[model samples]
Structure formats: C-alpha cells, structure tokens
Target: MAGNSWILHRNSSVNFEKIGDSAHTMLIADASEPYEVFGSTTNWRDPELARNTGPQSFGNCFPGETFVLLADGRVIQVPLVENERWKLLRGREELRPDPLATQRPDTPWELGDRPYVPRPRQQSGNRNR
Candidate 1:
C-alpha cells in the first residue's frame, strides 16, 4: 500500500474552475468523505465516463481494490481491496446523486471485467502529520 495518500481539501490549488468550464467538472474526491467532490459542485458528469471509469475508481470500485483517502486530501486511488476494511470505504449511507442506484449494494458491488488494484491501506499513523 502507498503510505502517502493525496487528500483533497474543499479549497485546493487545483484549477477546478477552469476544469469545470471544460469537461463536466472532473471531481477530486475523498474516499473517506463521499460528499466532498472537487470543483465546488455536486457530482455532475458524463454518466458513460463515470460508469466506464467506475471500474477503476474507489467511488465506483469493484470487489477487490482497497480505497484510501490521501493524507494530503487532494485525491484518492484504489489500493488493495482484498482486505475486509475496503468494504467500509464503500458508499453506505452517504448522500447520492441517484438514490435509487446508491440504495442497492448489489448494484455497486458487482464485479467488473477489468478491476482496479489500489495500493494497500496505509498503516495507521505511518506518515508525518
């Protein structure tokens, strides 16, 4: 697992305003905080891309990738979801763009043909705070 995670703050240095003007707001998100997407907007984007990339994203993770929140808080990536803790990272009671879809665990937990393998979760307190 990559001990260094990139945690994205709500107000980061990313050119989100510019990015938003182009592709439907490329969201920088926190794995631990589902509500915190980058670009100062709700998750609004090309459903096809989101769903397609979903296979590789912790937000849209498959059955076996560990999702970790970056300590910097700018970004998150799939690690080794093989462990049991990754399931906790999965969306549960988090708010949703589509309540119908988010409500179903079966919908999100479905295995993808090409799965993502994020770095393993960092050991607690392994980094210099």
Candidate 2:
C-alpha cells in the first residue's frame, strides 16, 4: 500500500482496495443488493465527483439532494443536480452546463435585467499595472 486510495467503488459497491494491485475491480453485488442505480449501469464510484472531493461535490448529497447508501454498504444513491462544476470534473466531452446559468463571469448579469451584479464599488486609485 502506497497510501494512494484504500477505498474505491466497483460495480456500484464500496470497498477497500490497495493501489497498484487489481482485485476484481468489481463489487459483484449479491442477490440482496441489486446493481441498479444512477439512471445507468451499477457504478459505485462517482465518476462525476473528483478524486478526494468526497460527497461534498454532489448538490443533493448534502443539505439538498437526499443521499442514500445501500444496505450491504456498497452503493451510494445521490440525487445529483447537473452543474458546470460537475461536468468539468466528469473528465469527458459531455460538458455540463453552468451551475449559475443566470450569472456569467465574462458578461456579468444584473440583479434584475442588467449586466452587472448589484454591489457597492470602491473608487479606483492612481496605480498603473
């Protein structure tokens, strides 16, 4: 073990696996624990979440989406809300839309219909960059 990742998901199940060594790489769900989840094949490891980010990445995982864990302690069901952050972390071409669609950093949007957020601004000083 090289302190890489002792925990990983395979076939929609959670288990501890040492690094560099391949052991099945699959949970092989039991009869009691069905392998159906996340609107697709049973994949326990959250591809949407970046490594080491933890459950905080998912919107519904905490304070919002209800996080559900399997009885056998294998799978985790999180009602995720698609956002730009998630898409970028997906590491795929299917980029996810921005979390804040209304507000764009490049072209700021007004609190109502303008293109700038309503906030108190400070006067500029005599400084050349």
Candidate 3:
C-alpha cells in the first residue's frame, strides 16, 4: 500500500462524506513488504477497475467500505464489523479466509482485477498541505 492513501468503493454511488456509522474501519499491519496500490483516486478513474486485481480477499470487500492504505503497507477499513477483525500476522504466516465472509457477496468493492490505487491528498489552501 502507498504511504497514507485513501480508496473508494467500486460500486458505490455515494461519496465518503455522505456515509455515516455503517462504515467499518480497520488497521492492517504490513508485517512484511509494501503492497502496490491499484486504484488510487488520482491514478484510477473507475473504482471498479480494481475489482480484477489484487488478492481474492479484497474481491468480497463491500463498496461502502473505505480503505486507508498506510505507508508501512498497513490497511485500515472503516466501521468495524461484528465478530470480524483484521489481525496482525507474523512473518511467513498466511491469512485464512473466513467461510462466513466467503459466502457473503455484499462487499461494495472488488479489488481482485486491478491494482489498488492511492487516493491523492486534498489540496488545502495554496500549499497542498
């Protein structure tokens, strides 16, 4: 993941500002190497393009779910879901998929077809800070 990036839901018609408490956010640690973002807002025009790339785990991700990509390769999903959490994995350890989640296709976005993109920072004043 790119250092401090934002991602939008692929199928979402509504923007982040309109969404409320229903959003579940999470912080995923990048215990290892950095991940290349596929659909950053500045680079990608269509959010759905990412649905073809990346890990299958992201394929089932919902569109309303906003992902915050960290510089350390960590990822954060907003609005935590019930009984669901992102655990920090150790070296060489693999993440097993949840059978329950696999069965549900309600994820708002798909990140399996394209690479994840880094959301460009908003321009504040004239400094871009």
Candidate 4:
C-alpha cells in the first residue's frame, strides 16, 4: 500500500496487486480489527457502499494521486478527490481531458498529449580540425 501500487477490477470486484511480484495479494475488507480479507467477489455495484467507502478503500495509497494500469495495458495517472468514491468507477472516468491530462514521469512521452520536446544536444569540447 506504499510505493508503486497496482489494481485489478474483474468480475464486478476489485483487487490490488503488488508491483514487481507474483505473490497473490489479498483484498482487505476491513483494515481494522478482525482484519477480514474478501474471500469472494464483492457486490461492488452498490452505489451507497461505494460512496461511503471512499477512494482509499479502492487501493488508492497516495493522498493526491494514484496510478492505475488498465486491462488494455494502458497506464493512467488519476488525481484523487478528497472523500470521493472510485470503487464503482471505470479507469477512463478518472482520466482528465486532453488539455488537462498529465503525463506521469515514468510514462513514455510519445503516449502523452503533449508533443515531445527533446533537450538540445551539447557540442563536443573537441572541435573538428
């Protein structure tokens, strides 16, 4: 739940996976006492539950933003809204419009809306004789 988090939504349920590891990650139903892990698919379509749980319950570790990898292999950085629910929302819903879209540092420049701007090349100290 710290650095570099990954999430998966399948069969009407959401789960979190650790980046760079093949281990099975459990979905904690309640992070409090009893510490129950979701054993089966959850009823994620319930709007009331989603609104009450908030975004953090949906694997958003960062306070301001969270990076999500879509099923189509596309990665998107979503800006978090305080106390907002994202459990029932699709990945595309969190995406900002073209003009406001932000490209993550790890994302390739070519995939972003902004045109690639390369740094100027430095001239060699030794000039051609």
Candidate 5:
C-alpha cells in the first residue's frame, strides 16, 4: 500500500458537510491495500486544501489516536504508540517522518491546557486628522 496509514475525517463519517473551519480528523491504517475511501470530502470536497492543510495527512488527524479499517470497511479506533511511525508513498517515492520529530504526549489533551485565545486587533489612527 502506498500509504501505511490514512486519514479519515470523523465528522465526515457522521455527515458529509464540509467543515468550513475545522473537522475532527483521524489517522487510520490497514495491513494490506489502502481502504477504498469514498465520500464528498474525498471526491467533491476541495482537494488542494484537503491535501495541503486539512484531513489528509499525518498526526494532524485526531492528534493522539490511530484507527484501523476492517475488511468490511468499518472503522475501529486504536491507540497511538509514541514510537510507531508510518510512511506515505507516491509511485516510487516515499515520504517519511523525521525520526527526531516523532515525540508526542501520551494524551492528546493535557490537563489544564488552556484553549486558544486570539489576540485582539489594533485599529489604525486616521493620518488625515
């Protein structure tokens, strides 16, 4: 398989609507062929955004959980091991994660972690005054 692991949008499975902002994404794997993924997110949805920044790559999916698709195509959750690594390949080329970059926290969300807070924008003064 070209992809040792594949990403699936958890939200997509629940509903086909595109998450204009963000979606709950997850990484999944199988021992043999790449799961024949299907859905609006896979087909009708934006491809570039999907491939570049959205739910189509690595650890960005669900952060700390791994999943496996069964032969019947049902998805089941799995735990992500800190040292387990996967590779993505295109034809004869392969993309692998840097060994040094593989460290991750055991839990996806640390206790007491603060949620993101965007900084307020500053307004510019009228120079013509």
Candidate 6:
C-alpha cells in the first residue's frame, strides 16, 4: 500500500491560471522513497516502462477514480477512463507544436485550448493614509 503511494508536488515556478471555477494544471507526481522516480507526463501502461513510472500505475487500487489535491485546498476525484488515461499526463507538449514533427493523439477533453487567464492580484498594504 505505502509502496504504491505518490506525492504530488506543484511546480512553484509556474503560476496556475484559472478558467471558470477550476484550474486544471500540471503537477509533478513523484513516487515515494524507494521508488523515487520521475513519473510526470508519462503513460503508466507503457509496456516497456516500469510499474512505478507514474501515478496511473496504481489506478486499479482506487477502483475507478483518481484523487487529486488542488492548490486551493480542494480535493477532487477524477474518474479513470481507459481512453482518457493519457490525459492525466498534461505535459507542456500538449500546448506547443511538437518539434519532432510528430502528431499527437486527439483527446476527448480540450487540451491547451482553454482560455486560462491569470487571476488578478489583490491590492494590499497601507490604505489608511
């Protein structure tokens, strides 16, 4: 059980832009301790890859859902669909055109097409002048 768990680390350098009410962003999902490996933006079901390669590897453990903790302190449970498994990757490559001249597979969900505007910063500091 513990061996299959992973820690989802948010990339502090990147600011998450909001769309509507939720922010669907990329997170670095790393396996714990002994299995400490880079698991983000990868296909967990790849035959040539190891089982500990990505968070999706433990999909069977949760039945049909994968839980995610948002930056706003909200936890979400996303369903694990066979065809949408790769959508969990959310790599930057999904935004820009692939330099390798390869075509990316089409997904049912909109990828990199959403208008994610950065949230306006609230004004703070001295105001009682």
| Winner by lDDT | 6
Q: What tens-digit string does per-residue lDDT give for candidate 3 at 1-129? A: 221111222232433333222223222212111123344331211211232134322212233343544323455553323113322211111122223322323333447896444343222233334
lDDT of 4 by residue, 14-94 (tens): 223222222212122221111112341221221123211342233332335545444434555545562243342333222
> Each candidate's TM vs. the true structure?
0.23, 0.18, 0.21, 0.26, 0.22, 0.31
Per-residue accuracy of model 2 over 27-127 as CA lDDT, tens digit each: 22111112222232212333344322332122221322223222234443323353342333323222222334212134433336654333332332345
lDDT (0-100) at residue 26 of candidate 6? 26
What is the Cα-based lDDT of residue 62 in candidate 3?
36
Winner of 4 and 5 under lDDT: 4
Clashing pairs in 4: none
Better of 4 and 6 by TM-score: 6
Candidate 5 residue-wise lDDT at 103: 31
- In the range 72-128, model 5's lDDT, one tens digit per residue, is 346654444432222211111222233333232233332267632323323324546
Q: Give the winner by lDDT: 2 or 3.
A: 3
Kindly list the per-residue Cα lDDT of model 6 for residues 1-129, writing each as its tens digit.
Answer: 111111222221333442112244323222211221233222222211232334334332334444544344564565555325335334333232222322223432232776323233232234454
Candidate 2 RMSD computed on C-alpha atoms after optimal superposition onto the true structure: 18.0
Work out how many backbone clashes candidate 6 has.
0
Top-TM-score candidate index: 6
lDDT of predicted model 6: 0.31
Candidate 3 wrong stretches, greater than 4 Å: 2-7, 22-54, 58-83, 86-129
lDDT of 5 at 68: 40
Task: Look at candidate 3 and tell me the lDDT of residue 98.
Answer: 27
